[model samples]
Target: MFFRALLLLLILLCSNCENQKGETSPILQGLLALDYLILSDPDRSSVYFSTTRSASVEIAYEDGAEPNTGNFAVAPTTSVWSVTESNLINAFADRGYTVNVTVPTDLSSMSEFPDQGRSTWTINQLLALVPKYKAEDSNFQSAKFFVVFVKGSLAENSGVIAVTVSGAFGIGAPTVFVFKEIINHFQDNLSPDKVRKAEQMTVTHELGHALGLVNTGIPLSSDHQDTAHGNHCTNTSCGMYWALGDDRVDSFSPGTNPLIFGSECITDIRDYTP
Candidate 1:
């Protein structure tokens, strides 16, 4: 009986050690860098990071001039693309991973060129564009989230990140929508650098939602919690905070390296990622 007892204790200890190792595996912390492509300028944007290669990105632009259409503009210089890509990569890198970006030829012309006067496109119109590109490649099936630019009002109800989570796993991948009206509001009120940083913050914030982060107050009992499982940021400075303003880029600042979700959120993502 004593020998059997010793054997059982040894088995339990070995099991515990294996569990701890699984929790700390490097794969859990490894970076998955994203590549960008305008689709239209595929050649120029094809470059990628040496470590952990990236998948292609396709951006679609909405015609801003049509009646009721929104105003979205892309910078004339290639530097704009580079700067945006660099900003996103840096945001991820700050969290301990190296990121690389690539711009595709198809996305070159996918600038925000919305007309100043019209407001015809609705959220549904913008969402319809997602499947077009998502179906183009199989890699997108694994994307943590996707970002799209749209022309619309930045009024309190103007922008949002739509999330879809399954059962108890919490949030699945998220799709980020940037409104032209909000971007313009920042441009007029803040410095260029601030505007750019704000844009990056918004996109990153939406991606956080896609990755299982949730607001502090949202009831876990709700079905939404089953999928949207990240922590809520009470710190207004943190990106996870839900209340953000259109006029100030700093309104979105929790710093680039936003905090991870509570234990629940982490568990959900761990189950989903692998």
Candidate 2:
């Protein structure tokens, strides 16, 4: 409604300006003042509300685990994806964003995850099963996002554990797809806490993409974006670190190097006024 009013006002002013030629009438001045007020109004523009964002998660689960061990509906917080969500929530909060995460109670089957035993699935292929996060909002200024958890791993040939993709040529619609098999691999290799940290770091790193870190969309504080690393930070300690997660796990035990978000990446998200 506000947008409509703004558009109508603009159209009327444009028509009046056209009809009146160059005559600076009182009515034209009034219209100009109204336009200035509209642009400066907090309720009309996004200047006041850019600080908050809403985010949600959808988990794609396997109906039946081949080993009958893994389940998505169990204590959701115990899920590796939950760890990831928690880290994201904290990161955004630190950046002064209000993050809301909702996990659907019902778990969908592996069919929602992949074609068969092990297959590669695209973002559209997966998002078809569930809708992205949306708001029943009168105010359209809020930032909204959806992060998806695919219950199975990608094809063995595909060396990646997860990928972050944006909608329509990476312009806006932000979503993250995490392969459960990757978390499963970490769970087997690391201790319980370390596994949790690994999951948290994995999701946090991907969430960085959605937040436009490493010069993807968010401007860098420095010329430190590792283009060679593909939208990853050059500093290894940063959450946007580009190295393969599995490779880093073997190398950096909690005793030596901890999983944490880099200050550079955090600053990018926090200070990104756009």
Supply every candidate's count of residue pairs whose N, Cα or C atoms clash at under 3 angstroms: 33, 1
Candidate number of the best TM-score: 2
Error of 2 at 240 (Å): 1.1
Instruction: Check candidate 2 and list the clashing pairs.
Output: 239-262
lDDT of 2 by residue, 188-220 (tens): 556545554555566667766765667766667
> Model 1 lDDT vs. the true structure?
0.40
Q: Summing lDDT over every window of 10 consecutive residues in candidate 2, give the lowest-scoring window.
A: 65-74
Clashes of 2: 1
The reply for model 2, stretches above 4 Å from the true place, is: 1-53, 64-86, 93-118, 122-124, 130-144, 155-157, 186-188, 244-259
CA shift of 182, model 1, Å: 2.0
* Cα deviation of 172, candidate 1, in Å: 8.6
TM of each candidate vs. truth: 0.45, 0.58
